[model samples]
Target chain A: MANITTNPESAGGSLTARALREGFYAGIVSLGLFVLFVGLETTQNIRNELVLRQRWGLLLTFVLVAAVGRFLTVAYVRPWVAARKAAAVARVRDESAPDSFFKRNFNAIAIVALILYPILAMLIFGVQGSLKWVDNFGIQILIYVMLAWGLNIVVGLAGLLDLGYVAFYAVGAYSYALLSQHFGFSFWVLLPLAGILAAFWGMILGFPVLRLKGDYLAIVTLAFGEIIRLVLINWTEVTRGTFGISSIPKASVFGIWSFDVGAANNFAKVFGLPMSSAYYKVFLFYLILALALLTAYVTIRLRRMPVGRAWEALREDEIACRSLGINTVTTKLTAFSIGAMFGGFAGSFFAVRQGFVSPESFVFLESAIILSIVVLGGMGSLVGIAVAAAVMVGGTELLREMQFLKQIFGPDFTPELYRMLIFGLAMVIVMVWKPRGFVGSREPTAFLKERKAVSGSFTKEGHG
Target chain B: MAPETNTATDTMTNDPILKVEHLSMRFGGLMAINDLSFEAQRGEITALIGPNGAGKTTVFNCVTGFYKPTMGMISMRQASGKTFLLERMPDFEITRDAKVARTFQNIRLFTGLTVLENLLVAQHNTLMKASGYTILGLLGLPAYKNASAASIELAKHWLEKAHLIERADDPAGDLPYGAQRRLEIARAMCTGPEFLCLDEPAAGLNPRESLALNELLTGIRRDTGTSILLIEHDMSVVMEISDHVVVLEYGQKISDGTPDHVKNDPKVIAAYLGVEDEEVEEVIEEIEEIEEGGKH
Candidate 1:
């Protein structure tokens, strides 16, 4: 964050001097650390009747890199960055120029990639191997993508920071679990049922607390989430308490096709296909793919409607929204219900995918993860959230394959142990680097002949 | 559509479009407005002028249904031969049903949205209908598309009026302060309101901007046939555009007449140009005495 200023020459002079001072100070500090590190390790080796290890070369490497890196950063990197920023400002006048070919065609490319993802996965990993990649990475990330998209309608577009969105997910999962277990409702029958139930609960939870705003709203929504979890835990008779509902029926296409093990009506046999169970994973993959697209489609459509504009307006200024005749109560409630409905859809899929429902799956951590995806992606950005979800969820799942690290850190080293630790660190690094997410632009629902991206930085305070 | 039935008597006038009959508002121990009454005739700019904290904004809030009055009624007689109680309605209904729109003392445009979107949001009630409450719109239905196009047309028309058509796609926040003030009024006008309440429309405007505002307010009254209720401390704007003037002090109507009459009214001058507490008492006494003498 070296700010650009008018007098670049003078500023550059001062910057170099400061860099030299910093480098000198760092050099002294590095020398002290070097002696301490070498002396302590060497003394231990000497006491243990071993050769006193002298690692001067390694210490010198660290010292040189630190001093030279800081000097180079100040002398060259900072001024280069400042010059580039000035050039960008000059380029703003000629903004009628079209975006680069790749940037303009990015959406079309992304859609094509999504459509061909399954076949590509199959080709790369073969049939059986592709199932893990599809189910663990593709389906898993898409669920979060859908969750983030749903939450985008609330936190992103609507500007309501809903921390406890997982409550709706739990509501959907339990709805499908309970309804299927007791009433014998099929997946098709209960799928919409789960969504409706979650939506109703969203309204119930939203009504009382919609008046609260910002931190107050966040706190109340959080309490609502904890209440749902407590209800599930305490109301053991209905939800089976902490033990959870097990052996939940798998979801199928119209109840005729299922992925059950070697059943007479197994989907693999019914379709007269191969006996591989990867068929089910592939189907689940496509199922989630369809569902995620539906979520994105609905969100894009809603953003252009009066209701959607009302939500953005309310987000910008509540007082202004009321004066303009936008029914804030209706707008907020609709956002909550619709967002929760999508959460429910994803939740029901989660239940059938796992073939079980448990309180452990519907924890506060889950809500935090979904919310992180939305924030780390751009708020109200459909593609941003999808990319963020893939990076976060798929990346975490990818950690399981890092067994090669044992070569560096000994045979006992395991990478999975530090997954969350690394994830948290990465989040901090990213947020500090770019306070706004990757695509923090507010694209107006209605525009003239040309559509321009309005950076959120220019947006009024309360709205962002 | 409903037939106009003259209710219990409000002795202000026979045909004023917006009538505030003895409206009062109190917050905690503060009487923000006390028994204030005014009438804004159809297609005329009525100015509400007062010193700071005179509760002019409070009255606007009451008429717009942002604050329900503690006493009395605000009524609007729309062209449909229907009279709606403004105080009884909810905030949104005042705009959607009563067809009354307002701008704020401080500009409150949706700064994140484009200048065009702000106008579209003003026509939310109309487009929402064509959207069939969103289902048809989601399906990309023809009716919704036609309505959306129409709403954009309306937005463009207002942007042209505000001289901001070029910045239609620019974020509302990016506009200069003067342009933003004009955009606010234009956004309110896009609602197709019969009654427009502008709170300090010229609050922070420059000389040229203020002149433009005067012309815009006058044009709205003349061309659109929309009655404007303006609250302004800027006397130049008040003197230029207003057809009628009501002066408030201590949350009481101190002077009520034409701009010429109210400008020379000693009580209004004493209240605005600064007066001692003793002089204020005298002005109130003079007003009450004049009110009683007129009644007799």
Candidate 2:
């Protein structure tokens, strides 16, 4: 196949071999930097006493190693790789066929995988006590996935930059917390209410910035998020301020029994087995999974609908959208409101799960993380966003258990500090390697016959 | 003047669909459209031709609600005798309610979307109307499904009309420049608008594309009873296709007549020649001398 043509210039030559050579050189440089850092920290005792003021030698060693690693890669590895890429580009003079079968079938495979995953977990690990695996990895990932999909509606579908997505999440969580606590409403009752409340807030946010565009809109949304957080913090009478509202009701077993087995409740009586938190976890998993899938399904359906297409039209070209008779203001408002509604759903689920509502929970960093998930996953891509969240969030969480890395870097070394550095590096690499996204395809909302995924291609800057 | 009066009476008897009454749009100190008045009759191709930056697009934009004019009223009368104040309505309402549609100078297809999707998006309001905007419709109600099916069929119909059926699945961006221009017109047509305003439809089209575009515009006017207002630079396209021609110079109306009359107007000739008042006589003398030399 045509896959072997790595050197875009030399169609006949071994392009893969060149890529291998470049990868090998990069590995050697990284290894060399690691060794040098170890030597400096252990033997040479080089120190930077001024900067961090804690462990001078270790800090200096890290700094030097990072600098040298980056410098070597930029000076040698990057140029060498770019030259090969240039060669490869020349080889592929006749642009390849735009469609790929693999890309087209990606969603089909993803749907199958999503369906099979819980079943496999139940079969292998059993459904009894698998909270750690199911809740942490599966449910948590799906929550972020839902949020990413929601934000995708605004940023990807509508081309409206919103930095206060977490505000909706806060609204949902607070809605659930306050309503459930006050009225003793079940999860199902609170869920829709929370979504509505969040949508209301979304419309409220939409009205002010109806005419704003680009960075100005982004700043306004960002300030709006901060204002919401501040209000939650200052409103001690209702929200209880920073102390937060605790003992928020957890989702019961289909309104049958609570997880608590005191004089008040008993799930064991209904199921004929001892009640376990695992039931709650499993139930929560399915609940959130359904919600996430609901978000995805609605988004897909909407895209094929008039409003969805209008959003894309607005995103692509606002001026043209207006001329087409698409009410851009209403279109934008619908996008924001819908996106916030989903965020609210995820937030309420979170509040119910944690049994708490704290201002600290809904932070700018959470919004950044969610936005990063959307960006890293690729805009308007459902599967890509989920995968990005899994990699980013799950990877960071997985890093906490890396006890062996401590042995290599000595007792005091923590990998968490390097997480941001690694994330930054990954982002830079992703930008250089796949500028569009990992699963870069401008996915269509609806398909003609069978839904086919389109591979992402480079769009002109102004167009995107 | 008596003959002019007779022709004016005949034109007025046709009953103008779009009436602009002393529409004056000023941008600070500059008058973009100064006391501009015109009438576009029903089921006719009205050509608005002008030099670059001559307020041709400004008139289109103001009519289409992209820009709110500083002064005057734009009244568009439908076949049903329902009148819409174009300036008073919101942009979307103008399209959704008033049934006015438009195309841009630069072909603005949702490049990322497929050829069919672009047309389907234009039919958004119609589909929404069929669905009733309820949760049942969202959950794949039979009516919604039928409407969606009809939408795709309508999209395919327009795509075929535009000669882009073979490239239906292709991303609109991948199409050649001329194809994109035609696609933009097809998209506007999908909306089923009473009046379609085209801004520089033949700007960058090759001769063959221009001919094809002429056929499409004529076909639309003939078959659909859709009035067309076109702003174009291609003299061949305008001269061959336009029923009525409105000429603008320096953001002001210099000539308004049929294609034959506008073509023969001295002011129109002088504007196209880019000649001053003093040079007009000299140029005419030079042209006569050239004709005399050719004869000799």
Candidate 3:
């Protein structure tokens, strides 16, 4: 709409005037929004009474920044974008141009990079220094990538908005924790068991909500998540309440090699290497990388199957799907169970890696973060979700290592304090710039002579 | 009802592909369809013509199992003499088991899917069974691969028939209006339906496109021996293609006969032209005098 209103051929003077007016409006709006938060601060004086302190100068500075930012964006960025768009339109594009070497082998390159991530980190930061890099960044980002991919099947392909997806993750985690603790089951035995349990719960959630759609479905799923968390918190006899299950056994390589330092069959003993915690982190990293790849592989393969097509058809239009003899009930349920299955896999991995399970870890915020990763990565695109997970999860983790910021802010400012604020601002910018996420185009699951990417405009977000 | 003037070529009236008996559908206080009964003979194009709001689509909804009739039975007897009660079955089962396929008045294609994919979805039941309910398919088994290829072949056949072979890989939503309508019909054909019910297949088509649609429908009837029942306001299409016509007015069957018989029926004429109860007789006389004058 703004594109239509702003004429490219406007007089130079008028353009500047318009930009100034728009900048002033933006500044006024920002002032109104920020005055209470920035202009005044509440403090406890020596007598322990609340006192109000004036920060008008800081408020003015913020207001001036907003004004200048708006002015520069309107005057420079908009015109530059419009000119680039015009140039692109004027040029006759070569539709059949071959892709660059990097573009053609992007997936292979990414896989290779992921396979070598932990080893590369060790070479760069050495043993102790690389533990934080590998465990905190590599393992952390991969877990989110797996979770987001799982949720993508439900929300992206099936177009079912599941607000309480973390419930399934919790189910998987707790299933592994309790079953292994009580039954003395190995991590290998409980991994698939956890997935099956989560899928069963997915079906349990799927049955009653079959008749519901849109906002109604979202609300029910949200309530279901909260219910699971509350149960975990209050079920003290089984779950240990808020104390959580602690000192859970670490995962092993098919019961052959354990990650423990003192275990007789430790990975270091088997490999004839020196004892180091980095070995555990590296092993866990590879395990998660394999699991994440499995999720991607299954999802991609399923998209080409009949059930997968039916899921997408249900997303397109339920009435039409029914008309075509596609059973929507089974289609939707399959999406739910399959999506939950992956979440379960990731949750079990999380439990093993952290050596604990707790209801607090499976909060609604986890679901929101996973969902945002899917949305920000462009729904239904595997590679895009991985990139988004790295940027969001790894980006936030990177903030904790910003020791240089202490020098600039007089050793008082903590970059982590502004993490959420920065995360939110980045989200807003991305949504405005690329509403369909980074990779908007859809690759057809099955193609004939030549495969063509379906434009974002042709796809629907779906009502479910 | 007008006298039965069903074509001599299709005299097997005892064996109708579809039979709707005493079907009535009520929406709250509005009687959308009142005790409507009609039979579409095997291997013939049957047209249900009516003025707007005469409950033409409501009857279709009942037959397709989208709306269960308040009171009545819709029986579809396949060629093998197997009878399925469509009204009792669920919407998908109506298509899956009864082998009854339908197109909507407003086009409802899987717009995001490719044109070929839209057709493959209609063959979902067949391929699903061959895939061993997707277990074997997911494993990339040879049997499932062969079945998938066969399904694609069937889709390609229909795509060629619909003159949409060129756009098979494009998203269904990206096609032109006429192409989308034809794709819907093509998708319905992919279901291998014993009885096809199309609601306003030529609703927004121009004359040339309508002519092409006529050819497609006739070719389908000739080649596949699939029975067709359509509701259309385009008299040109109804007159040119349909073997029998059923006319409705205000939720009641006003006329039923061959196309020529229904075209000459005074009730159908008045229904389309909107004449008052008292003025109907006068208009009938005016139509008769005009016909006599043309004869002279």
Best by lDDT: 3
TM-scores for every predicted model: 0.89, 0.83, 0.88
Off by over 4 Å in 1: A1-29, A40-97, A270-274, A460-464, B1-14, B275-296
Q: Which residues of candidate 3, in runs, are more than 4 Å off?
A: A1-83, A90-92, B1-13, B275-296
The sequence of per-residue lDDT tens digits that candidate 2 reaches over residues B216-240 is 9988887788888999999999999
Q: Once superposed on the true structure, which residue ranges of model 2 sit more than 4 Å away at CA?
A: A1-129, A263-265, A268-275, A446-455, A458-464, B1-13, B274-296
lDDT of 2 at B119: 85
lDDT string for model 2 (A126-199, tens) is 76746677777778888888899999999878888888899999999999999988998989899999999999
Candidate 1 lDDT by residue in tens digits, B5-77: 2211222234589989998899999999999888887766789999989999999989999898999889899
Q: Which model, 2 or 3, shows the larger TM-score?
A: 3
Least lDDT summed over 10 consecutive residues: which range in candidate 2 chain B?
B1-10
lDDT string for model 3 (A101-173, tens) is 9999999999999998888899999877889989999999999999999999999999999999999999999
Relative to the real complex, the DockQ score for model 2 comes to 0.39
CAPRI grade of model 1: medium
lDDT measured at residue A180 in model 1 versus the true structure, 0 to 100: 95
TM-score of 1: 0.89
Q: Candidate 2: deviation at residue A354, Å?
A: 0.7
Model 1's chain B yields a TM-score of: 0.88
